[model samples]
Target chain A: MYLVEKLGEKTIELFHSIFEIVQFLLLIFLHLVNPKSYNPAMRMVLTKQIYFTAIGIIPIFILMAIIFGSVVIGVVIYLSTAYSLESEIGSIIITFVVDEFAPFFTALLISLRSGAAINTEIAVMSVNKELNTLKEYKIDIIDYLFLPRIISGIISVTSLSFLFALIMLGSGYLFTFFYMDMDFNTYKYLLLNAIELRDILTLIFKSFAFGFVIMLIPIYSGLKTQNHYTAIPVSVLNGMVRLFVAVFFIEVLSLIIQFF
Target chain B: MCENIALIKAVHENMSISEANTLAVEMLSMIGLQKIAYKRVENCSKDELLLVMFIRALMTKEKSVILKLPSEIIGGLFHIENILKDMRKVNTSKEIFVCDLVSSKAYYKECECHIEESN
Candidate 1:
């Protein structure tokens, strides 16, 4: 009976969290579409966010992409050749690396880095009453704070995913050249032939969803923090855990959609 | 420091960035702290923090300002006279009201601002 009660409470908590996130998403969408929300302060914040979350991480991101991309592409090519499925190398890379791995890996990295930072920032702002300082002067916290971070998250994830895909595809060619003795023209032709419009659409949609939730979950978790200093780390932990769950959920959902 | 004052105008009033920054600098100059325009919050002295908060309050476009326990907010020894002198230098028409404990009423006795005593 005690176990049953605990399970019921967990289920209710899960649904309540989902409902709150959806409501917050709707509010963000409303503010996103409104031009007035892009005041100078918001624009400045958005620019800074983009620079911090995207541009600042580029060198590390590219380095990781090159190393990870080479290993994955090398393994995929070796296996495909072993099975005498060399002709299908392009489709395999597209299906696995571009459509599946790029956005997922990028989101995870961002969630670990920028997402946690944003959670801590908002939590600290709340605890310090800096958010109240803005409120006291009629400044919209949603416009000045949340919207910019969320938008930057979306932009960073989407663009970085595309860049990851490019890097992986480039590294795939290098593997083919060094190991398989395949010519650039042939490799290019194979990739171009295997590429389909749906793959591109899926990448975009999946990246968008991943980006939205990564930022949204963290900000939501941060706002959940109690107005105490100790609560900051707790909120960041909650946000990171929830962000990973959301990222995996999106990836799985996208795969299921592709399967059908 | 100045951005704290400028943010309200930039966000709420949709003012341009440079214009808002210029206005913020001008306001800081009013309190003779314009040199700290680019200074970060942590590096500020308690008195500067209090004045920055005061200027931020003034940015609200409210016709009157109520300061709730100014000395406690500064978190150190401060004279109500100096703060009032600074406020007067800013030269705004806003009505200033200082609210403090009745026990602390003696502190504001020399200041030229009105004080509301509460039992």
Candidate 2:
């Protein structure tokens, strides 16, 4: 009886989560389709979100991307030489680093940083009756707050993923040039040749999907918070964990769609 | 509440920018807050904010308005009564719901319906 109850509870929770995500996505779609959604206030919110989520982290993101690219390239070079698989280096990097790691790491970074902040902020607002205040004013929270954040998240993640991939590719070339005596033309040719149209499309889709999930999960978690201070931390924790899982799920799904 | 007022006046009322400005000026003048009309809410006093919220809800022309009056405003019952009187002049048909603490029940003696909840 106890085991059955636990399973039922878990299943109910899962369904609730799916329902919330689908409802949020519908709200986002409605906000986008409605021309009135793009008011001056929403524009201000979008700009702020983009600044915080993307622009603020550029320096650290670049540094991390360079380090990651160099490490991956170093390993690939050593392994390829040992196994006499030098010809496959470009394909490995393109498939694993550019297509997968760029979006995955970008989502992970954003989930840890902005995701936690959004969840906590909204949770606190809910607890403090701020959301109720907005409601009393007849302000649609979805239009004024959630939509801008969601749109900004998608834009920021997509742009950052592109930047991350470009920087990583450059770093990979630099590492090979300095350590392995590989020519720039050869490295560029190999990478460009290995990258297919499908890979690029898959990367784009993954970034957008991952970005949507990261922002949506946090907002949903925050909204789930009751009018209690204790719920804020719990919401943030749940949002972060769910965000990480969602990002991985998106990455794997995109890869599977691309290959199979 | 101040934000709510601004939003409703600016958006829901379908007032043009200049029209909204004029309405804001008129409302602020009534509350003796014309000087601080354009100032940010963060800088406004509690009373000023509450007054703005009151005026905003009145301007919406909605059939019903529910306001949760802060404890500070409850102590100034006379001021609230005056605002309600002014609101009646502009909108006699509007139903106003003022949710307040049990200690603040005395101020709503003239209200049509009173529902009290105890903790």
Candidate 3:
């Protein structure tokens, strides 16, 4: 009987989570459909979000991408050479680096950094009655708060993922030059030739979806926080965990679709 | 049927950039807070913030406005009275709902009803 009750509770929690996500997405859709939603104040907020999430992290993101890309390229080259399958280097790099690692790493970085911050900030606002204060002022929270963050998340993630792919691919070429007797032009040719239109489109779609989940999960968790101070940390933890799970889920789904 | 209705809380209000600036200056001067009118809200004292919010709510030409007084400022009946007086000057016909922890019947002569929360 206890086991059945726990299962039922879990099922209900899952349904609630889905409902919250759908509700948030609906709000974003409504904002897009309404021209009145756009204002200078919201534009300022969106620009700030993009700056903090994408532009601010560029230095660290580039460093991490370089290290990871070099390591992956080194391993791929060593393995391919040992097995005498050197010709397939471009295909392997395209499949692994461009299609998978770029979006996954970008999502992970964003979720860990910006997602946690957004979650904690929103949670604090909710707990402090700031959100209630906004309501009292007859301000639309959706137009002022949610829409800007949502648009920022989508734009930042897509742009950052593209930048990550470009930097990593360049790093791979530099590693090839240092570790092996390969020309930069040859490596560039191989990578560019292997990348197809479908791969680019898939990468874009995955980044967009991952971005949506990153912002949505954090915002949802933050909104769940009540007036209690204890709820803030709990909301942040829940948001981060859910964001990572959603990222991996999307990545796996994309891979399956591409292969099958 | 004013195009904008505002509930005054903290320092946030719904107004165009130009209107907000103009109103903020005018209301600050009216409330004897002209010196700190342009300062960031985060730097303002609780009383100052409350005064700003009161003025913001009053500036709205809307038919109905809601003003939520933070619990900290409820004891300041003098400030509340001045706010109501200033509001009367702006739009005598506009209906105002002042929600606070304390009953403000003594300070506001125009208030028609008092609604208390039952614990």
DockQ each candidate and list the results. 0.82, 0.18, 0.16
lDDT (Cα, 0-100) at A238 in candidate 1: 87
TM-score of chain B of each: 0.90, 0.63, 0.50
lDDT of 2 by residue, B7-111 (tens): 665555445445666766676676566777777767877666766777777767588777776556534665555555544444236777777778767766764
Alpha-carbon runs more than 4 Å astray in model 1:
A1-11, B115-119
TM-score of each: 0.94, 0.78, 0.81
Candidate 3, residue B27: lDDT: 54
Top DockQ hit: 1
Provide fnat values for all models in the order shown. Answer: 0.90, 0.05, 0.05
* Tens digit of per-residue lDDT, candidate 3, span A42-115: 66568889999899999999999889878887888888878987898888888787788888889999999989
DockQ result, candidate 3? 0.16
User: Which portions of model 2 show Cα errors greater than 4 Å?
Assistant: A1-17, B1-6, B9-44, B55-119
| All models, RMSD in angstroms | 1.8, 5.3, 5.2
Q: Isolated chain A: TM-score per model?
A: 0.95, 0.93, 0.94
Estimate the lDDT of model 1: 0.88
Model 3 reaches an interface RMSD of: 6.2
Per-candidate clashes come to 0, 0, 1
lDDT of 2 by residue, A98-180 (tens): 68888888999888888899999889888988888778777778877898888888999999999998998899888789877
Which one wins by lDDT: 1 or 2?
Answer: 1
Candidate 3 lDDT, tens digit per residue, B1-119? 01121222112443455565555566566556777766766667766666666566665556776766644554466556555555554423667677765464555554435555644
